[model samples]
Target: GYKGDQIRDFFLTYGDQGRDVTVNLASGGSPQWYGDPQTEDWEVTLVETGTGARIKRVAAYLDQPYFLQTYGDGIGNVDIGALYTQHVASGLVSTVTGVHPTSRFGEMHVSGERVTEFNEKPTMADGWVSGGFFAHKREMVDRYLDDDPDLLLEKKPMQTLASDGELGVFTHEGFWMGMDTFRDWTELNGLWDSGDAAWKVWA
Candidate 1:
């Protein structure tokens, strides 16, 4: 509910794009939408829940076998259908998109106190981190998550799922970036402006 008002106003203005929206609030009240919502087929429900409680709260309103989850700060061209296919094929409760992020500083390969190779801020070649894209079975909500206000999906929940052999990873070797800081924001905007944003796979 950090930007509850702004989010509500945005959906109220342009949420009729074939899908319904439900804005969960941490505060305990549902405010009315002004004017007509412009759609008879779509429904919008504004309710009370925070990040920690979002998965459980949202799952309560859903009747599907699979649910998608991701952080709002990251953008990527991850193939959702492929991810879901992998998740189901693995018979896992959760599948997270793993990405190789770029290193922030210059990289140097040294041999006996001598620099053998150097690359400036190269993409990490050895490890993958969560790109924040996720595909999950609805069972994951009840089985791996909880209602505690401090329950983080990336923490105990994911760890427990991994320990239980219910977690899978989809390796995404495409463009992915996280807008966590001002520099990242600027860089992403620059990519868009230059028409070099690899994540723009749709028209």
Candidate 2:
């Protein structure tokens, strides 16, 4: 999934060292590695899965009772410490970050042809979408994950969790963005330049 020392370097920048980071990536059949990086404390291992391996492959390397899995490109200002606490308290197999996606267009409430209320790029309050930040218990992964290589983490597994009343959600009303396109990259850069990034949780 992830290549090179970028992850290691990132954590080093934040003064976190000697961390074991496991990344699961399934391109076509499984993950393929590129090379090795020489680092002191940080170590990132790449695990290969099929296109549908989803997050199940991570169960193999999940050392802790609880592990956090976040998309490399997704950024948010979620209180992860609090999320961990909630997951433990709820005793669910999994807990994921729930975010209200911002509307691409402005919203207008009209009353008798009069613009009563207008909100520009407002956050949607109807349904929440998963922000790709996940916390999972070993048992959850062990019980749900299979080697089929066609399973989707967000599909049947998640649905089963919901059906079994085992899914927990930590709602975040703050900003959440994924750097998927050039426009997204530019927007994040703009926020960085303007010092107005809502996802900046660090000092």
Candidate 3:
């Protein structure tokens, strides 16, 4: 049902526009289906370790001393440049953008152009959670992660980093949402079509 040529053509069109985007299919355990990456533009980034490596797995592929990282399925309007600058100034090994994700279902009283009151989901008052936008020092990976692919980046490394004062945080008081449900998908599509998506950073 899927035509590889058509997809390749679509990619080529984008490539022609000077977009140096590399589509990587990461397959673990034993490489099946996608045996090898044939084109120079696209590649199969292989991770031989078992599974559940999470950020640690992806971090290994990066060659930069510091690289921006974010969840592919999450959308946010965080000021990335500010976060990077803060990270550099703090001299921390890792920095996660903390955010107050909009409440899923809540009641808000808006007067004129301001919200008078909102009683809903846990906000920044409840405490901040990792927004998935990160600036990581690549060398920290080897210091924190091991060969075990089952390691979760959030479990020990992050905690240890925080405990050792080696981690920094940038709070984002802007729009943020994770697309995880059908409702989220529909709403994101609606927002995209409406041309009012707050996370449209380029605009």
Task: Give the top-scoring candidate (lDDT).
Answer: 1
- The estimated TM-scores of all candidates read 0.80, 0.74, 0.67
Instruction: Give the alpha carbon lDDT tens digit for every residue of 37-151 in model 3.
Output: 3344454343333346555666657877787766556888889999999988888899999877666778688999999998875454567778889898887878887756667
Q: What is the C-alpha RMSD of each candidate to the true structure, in Å?
A: 7.7, 9.6, 10.0
Residues 1-203 of candidate 2: C-alpha lDDT, one tens digit per residue: 45435654665444333334444655445433344543556456555543666467656677778887787778889889988899889889999999888787899999997999999878889999998888888888778778787777888888999999999999988889878889779989999999999888865
Query: Which 10 consecutive positions of candidate 3 have the poorest summed lDDT?
Result: 30-39
Per-model C-alpha lDDT, please? 0.83, 0.78, 0.74
Residue 201 of candidate 2: its Cα lDDT?
80
lDDT order of candidates, top first: 1, 2, 3
- List residue ranges in candidate 3 displaced over 4 A: 1-13, 16-51, 54-61, 107-125
- How well does candidate 1 score on lDDT at residue 79? 93
Model 3: how far residue 194 lies from native, Å: 1.2
Clash number for each model: 0, 2, 0
State the displacement of the C-alpha of residue 157, model 1, in Å, after optimal TM-score superposition: 0.6
Model 3 RMSD vs true structure:
10.0
Error of 1 at 65 (Å): 0.8
